[model samples]
Target: MSKNSTLILEVKNLAKKFGDYVAVDGISFDIKESEILGFLGPNGAGKSTTINCILGLIKPEVGTIRIFGKDLFKKRSEIMQEVNYCSAESNLPWSLTVNECLRAYSALYAVKNASTKIDELLERFEIAEFKNKRMRNLSFGQRARASLCKALLNDPKLLLLDEPMASMDPDVVDRGIKLLLKIQKETGMSVLYTSHNMWEIEQVASKVVFVNHGKVMAQGTALELTRQEVQLEAKEPDLREVFIQLSRKAPEMEEK
Candidate 1:
């Protein structure tokens, strides 16, 4: 792929095995510029493992992950500079204030103009009031906001998010969704996000990849998936309905 091409991330025949069990079995996908691709799967469905391989946190025993047409493992450092990840459970240092945490992360990423970028993110997330508060002192919602700010500190071209709004209030969740859309619009960033909240995926995802048993079972626009499930007798085939239909087997109804 050409460097100027819109494809930012590519996973081809990516598979990982732990002792004889395959965690992710030969999955392939691509994320394009300015697209929000929802990675949906039930619990323990290899979603996290696939993401780890893409992030180079774990080496897949087979296949390749390419970012900007560069080999992911061989060019990890070069790729990491333009990519970042945030998870709901990932935490900053408890002893550090929010500002301190951001500063440390900025330095780690070798971000230029770190202070200015940190300030912009702080203001955008409206976390300036807690800038001096210790990480342990912040509420779950506040910490989620801080985590998002940290992820955005590098102005990354690719953002990997796992349950990005898991701890927020409904209002904050809405705000965060809006923020993500705005960021994608302004920066043309590509996002690969996983969330159990189907409604949020419906709202923000440009394309949805539904995974099951370590493979992609279905992928398309949310509307297309919903429409395709009309024959399944669902009253209204939304993402949740489509997800349940594809990921589970119906129990046999008892005879009258």
Candidate 2:
């Protein structure tokens, strides 16, 4: 990250609760412009809840969310114009053809030069062959590519991706990851990335936040956390081992 990098997204003391259970508890983090930040956690952790709050899909009972140096709630319309989100569970219209889906999403964002954007996205994702294919008919890997194409329609400044490579084969996953890195580098958009693949995280993320049971347990570069407490052979440390080490320990024992 640049020394004077601007913060594109800020979550301060964010909390979300459901009934008697706390889904997310007072977590705070920031994504710098032109940075990739990974959000990781074990199953049943508060990862999803925190993401929902950040996207404004669910209201947080406490804390504030700021995007582009403005309050998310008060400036939602303005903030959303340059912000876009995507998840592997993208429930796009199954009957719609790929082109139709992209067109509709572009209209929703009111993007100009719609046809040009659609073609560029399809070619970039290597999904132009399936432009006429229906969503329900496409394979999981193909659909994943289409889903990403839709997310890029608006040329967003901030992108939130939740398991963007889910259901993709090794080759497709590699392609998708590279495309994201390229977009960020060329456009300087901030990306908040979430996935279960530790190796993928190590490959793309510049910083990481590990949360469990609605609380953040650790925050640092992958190398920092992997080597800080665990002994290694001096070669690159595995992120999965670092995750296991952090999650398996008692909260009191893990570093704050």
Q: Each model's TM-score?
A: 0.91, 0.94
In Å, residue 80's CA in model 1 sits off its true spot by: 0.3
Off by over 4 Å in 2: 232-235, 252-256
lDDT of 2: 0.86
Give the clashing pairs for model 1.
none
TM-score of 2: 0.94
Query: Model 1 compared with the native: what TM-score?
Result: 0.91
For residues 79-123, write the lDDT of model 2, one tens digit per residue.
888988888887689999999999998998999999999999999
Candidate 1: segments with Cα more than 4 A from true spot: 1-5, 230-237, 249-256
